[model samples]
Every structure is written in structure tokens, then in C-alpha cells.
Target: MKRQFVTTENTLRFLEGFSALEKRGAEEACLMVVDGVPGLGKTSIIEWWAGQTGSVFLRAKKEWKPNWLLSELIEALGQVPRHGFEKRFKQATEILANKHEQFSMDRRPFAVVIDEIDHISNSEKMLETLRDLSDTLELPFIFVGMGKVRTRLTKFPQIASRVGQYVQFQDVSLDDVLAMAKNLCEVPIKRDLIEFLHRASRRKMREIKEGLSSIERFGAINPGKEIGLDEMAGKLLLNDRITGKPILVTADGFGGDNE
Candidate 1:
């Protein structure tokens, strides 16, 4: 499969949220929350932003503690882990502050993005640590997680209050599907077929990619046909369009499947 990253409308919204957060002064809020359903391309946007801004990016583990999180940040800053939690926390914040200063002088944005944060969202100490880091360093901290993450963070009022921006990713629209198909598909795919795949995948990014993979397979098998919904006859378009459903086996009994 061709490697591609399609910047959809949600991607633009995320960029705007971060841009707004970056423009804030030290007295203003620096923490941002991005939550949505699974497979909405939150992680992709996070990585893309991190790459563009040269920010530290980390993924929270289920067993992570405050010290582990601090150590990871330290490591990302090109430093070895310190012995104690306080030492690690201090070192990480100092490094981030220095980097933030440089980026400020260069008129660029600097941030630390944490992905898959649902696992650590319930830990009060972890949440407090993030808040402390953002406050002390005066650098933006972005948290990406599933839909309930916003509600889960509300359990910690202090942490929730520090959030300056909240972005909820919605399901991909037909236009988004078309853009992705145009960028990722090896062959030309009709607009209606793109919409069909979008609805078939339930507008989830992972499943939408799977649907594109199926289209690629069909194109390779039938080299001369223009890949479209009609051309995909006797082939699976998606695994299951809705919940508690069986696999969509084509009427002509093709072996291909989509998910």
C-alpha cells in the first residue's frame, strides 16, 4: 500500500486548536484536550503536529506512574533518567522550559503530546503531574484519547480547569472520504464509491483504510477496470455496515472481505 496521510477537516481543526493554544501567554492556559471515538485519526494528527513542531511525543502505558511519565519526557529531551521522581520531574520541566524559550525566540510553537491517555486519565497523581509540568514549563501539553476522556478528566477539577482548548473529532464526511481516496487509492475511485466505502466503514479511519485496501486489491486483480462501486460487484466492500451483523458476502460468492 502507498504510504499517505490525508489531512481532513478534523486535521485542520486540530491544527487550529494547537495554533490558538500556542499563541497564549504564560498567564493563559496551556493545556489542550482532544477526544473522540476510536479510529478517528487523533493519533495521526498528534504525530503530524509533533513532527512539524519538533515537540516531544509520548504514549501513556496502562501501568505508568508519575515518575515513569517524567522519565519518558526526560528521555525525549535527550537526557538520561534521574533517580527520583522529583529529580526527573525537575529535569524534564527545565529541559522543556529551555526548549520552549528557544522556540519562542524562533517564533515557533513547542508542545508535548500524549496519545492513548485513557489508561492514565483516572490517575489523580498522573493528571496533577501533567498540570504541574504545563504550568511550570509554560509549554502546551496535548492529550489525545477516546470520547470519555473529557468526562474522565472532569473528576480532577484543577486539571480540567487548566484545559484551554477542547477538540472533539467527528466521523469523516463524504468529502473527507473522497479526499482520502484521491490521495491514497492507487486507481481513480468514483465519488459515489468513495461515499459508499465511507458509510460502509462506519466513518472510522482504520476501517476506511481497510476499505481502500480492498479497492486496491480489486484494482490489481482487474487491471483494466476503473475501480468504482459498480466494478466492485461480487466483492466485499465492508465487513459489517452495522452492529451485531454477519460478514457481507457478495451474492456471487467472491472470497474477498473488507473490515
Candidate 2:
């Protein structure tokens, strides 16, 4: 079973561009910024790419102190000589440069996915450091952030200038959601059912997936049987009881859709 939300074309373009840069030369690691509303699956898309391309992925979190970000990178690259951020980044870069000698392709094609970058990207210093790394070392880097991120990034012209690719994740379309449901949930859906849920979900993947999950739960109770509209209407979180309509389930971030 395909346990993934389908990769949209805009996403595929970014992935292909990243690969093209890496395969061509040292300059391939130019900065990429992925901006989306919360729960749009930016991290999932990047991690999936990492698995396919052998790129190193680092997730930056809310509690991650500024220095810790650099420290972790240093440690991961086998170059943590000391605790200071600048020292560690310097040593790591040197070692990576050394390892990229004539004998082998650079393993340092590493992509540091700075998760939640919007938290610190507005900080002038941090943005400059990332910009410097991308400019000087030409490191492969990605910044993952929420809706306000792209707007925030525009504040720093220097950093914005280095961005080779920018991606804005739109909500999942109806066709894609239905396809993922039929293929991933092992449920052959009818057109009416698809329309019913699409109206309720506005085509968000998380919402549609959860609805399918509800369907699976229904099937679990009535084993080896199809979960038709009646069962869905009663047990599913989608239906509006009083009006007899499917209630729109809004995504309150974290990628899950809710009624």
C-alpha cells in the first residue's frame, strides 16, 4: 500500500531541481525554502526526498536554542571539536571539504532541513549565518516553515536572494484526495461518496484520510463488508446531524482534519 499523500507536481519540480543541482557540481546545494500553511506536509515531502536521494535531514524544533542548531550539525557531520556554534560549523565544514577529495563524491551533499525555521528566521543573526553557509560553503539547505514564513523571509533581502527555490503548499485537491483514499485505504469509492466528502473536507488530505480511517473503523466492526453511506452517516465524524449534510472538517494544523 502507498502510505503517502501523493507528491504534487510543484513539489516534484523542487525535488528534481535539487537533484539536478547536486548531480551537476558543487554549486548544487544552493538554498531552498519550503513554505506552507501548518500541516500541509512540508516535512513529509522533504523526508521522503531524503530517503530517495540519500540526503541528510535535520529537524529544527521550537526548543532548539540557536547554538544547539549549529552544535547538532557539527556532531552529526563527525566534526564536533568543541561546543561553540561557530567553531563547530567551521570544523565541520573543513572536514566535509577534506572528505570531498578526488576519490569520492561528497557525502556532504547533506541537506539540513531547518525545521520550524520561521521561529528564528526572523532573527537577523541566524538568517545571516544560514545565508553565509549557503553562500560560502554552498551547502544544501532547506528551510521549513509555516504560512507567515515566506512573508518573514522577505524582510532579509540578503537571505532571500540566496533562495534558489520557493514552494508554497496549497491544500490538497479533490481528485488527489479521492485517489489516495481508494489506493491507500483499499476502498473503492463511488463518485457520490467522493463528492459528499469533498464538500465536507474542501479537499484537505488530512481530513479525507481521517474520513477513510473512520471507514476502516466501520469495516473493522462489520468485517469483510463494504461500508456504505448509511454506516458512514451514522458513525463517521463528517455528517451534520440536524441538517443531514456533511459538516466541513477544518484542519487545525498538525496535518489532521477535524469536524
Candidate 3:
């Protein structure tokens, strides 16, 4: 399989939401929440976005406190963390403010991405610290989490009200699966095979990628032949997300022993 990032519908929606957040009138309202189920590619797309846009990306730890978050933010901004929590917080905000100014002068979008933010979503102190930073610097802060983040944030109306946008990533569609196959698969795959993989993987990006790899492996031996569902019958595509057993392609469709 080719190493590539395919642009799916979710990715486009994320970009649109980010753009809207950046252009919002109330500068203090700079928080954006991105939530989705597991294996929907939220972290993958956010990491890719950070790399491409020179944004700061950090993953929230389960034990994260205000001080720890400040320290990580300071480091991500390419500075040594200060000795005290207050000093670290000041240093991080200064660096972020400077970077935000530079990005503005260059007309580039800049923001901080906190992946796995559900870890800290319930901590009022941590969420208050995040809100303070955004309110102080008027900078965008993206909080990426699983489906619970949005519901959990309701407890903190001060933080939730500051959310400029809420982007929920959905499962990939058949068209998205076909696009991934065309962009990431090295072999020519028939529509039937792609459809089977889509259904078998339940339209999850990670599972689809695994299925694509299986097809690529089969293509490696077949050389230039176009692969169809028949050619992939009885081959292991991916493991069942629920059953933890290998899902194989059948002549009729796909199923695992447990299913």
C-alpha cells in the first residue's frame, strides 16, 4: 500500500470548521471541539494538520494537571519550561502570542491541538486553565476527543460557551472508501472488492486501511491483475472490532468465526 493521506469528507469538514473558528468575530471564543468514535481517524487527521500548518500538538494525559499542561505547551513552543507553574504559564502564553502574531502576519492559520482531550475534560482546573490561555491570547485551541467530550463539557458552561465550533467526525461512506482505495492502494481494485472491504470494515478508516493492505499483498503476487471480491475470497482482511477475531472474505460476503 502506498504511504499517503487520503482527503475524506471528515477531513474537509474539519478544515471548514477550523477556518470558521479562525474567522469568528468574538476573539475570546477560540475553542473548538472535535469528537468522534474510536478508529474514525480524529487523531490521525489532527496530527497531519498540525504537521502541515506548524501548529502545536499535544496529547492530554490521564493524570494531567494545569502545571503539566503548561509545561507541555511550553516545550511544544520550543522553549524550556520554567521552574514554577506561574512562570511556565506566563512563558507558554508569551510564546504562543508571539507565534500567533507571526502566523497572522504571514496570513497562515495557527492553533494548538490537544488530542485525547477527554482525559482532561472533566477537570475544571485544567479546562479553566485552557480557557484562560485562549481568553488571554485570543488564540484558537482545538480539543480533540472521543464522543464523550461534548457531553462532558456541558458541566462547564464557561468553557462550553467559548466553543466556536463543534465538529463531529462520522464513519466513512462508500465513496470515501473507494477514494481511499484509489489514492492509497497500489493495486487496481474492482468496485466489488472495495465495496466488500467497506462493508467488512464497517467504514472505519483504520479497518479500511487494514483491508487495503490485504488487497495490496494479494496484488503483490498477482502483479497487474485487477482484484475483485472473488480473488480475495477466504483472505484475511482485518480483525473484528468487537470480537477480536480475524475477518475473512467469503465468496458471498465477509464474516468471522464468531460472527
lDDT of each: 0.81, 0.62, 0.90
True-structure lDDT of candidate 2 = 0.62
The clash tally of candidate 1 reads 0
> Of the pair 1 and 3, which is ahead by lDDT?
3
Top TM-score model: 3
The estimated TM-scores of all candidates read 0.91, 0.76, 0.96
Candidate 1 residues 1-259, lDDT tens each?
6787788989988988987776666444889999998888899878987988898899999999998898888988899988999888878878888999999999988889999999999999898899898888767899999989999988998888888889999887778888888888888776656766765677888778878888888888888767765677656665664553533424343332334
Q: Highest lDDT: give the candidate number.
A: 3
lDDT for model 1 comes to 0.81
CA lDDT of 247 in candidate 3?
A: 83
What is the lDDT, from 0 to 100, of the residue 248 in candidate 3? 81
Please give the lDDT score for candidate 3: 0.90
| Model 3 bad stretches (over 4 Å) | 254-259
* Per-candidate alpha-carbon RMSD to the true structure: 3.4, 5.9, 1.8
- Indicate whether candidate 1 or candidate 2 has the larger lDDT: 1
lDDT of 2 by residue, 8-60 (tens): 65467567766665664436337777877754557777778766655556776
Residue pairs clashing, model 2: none
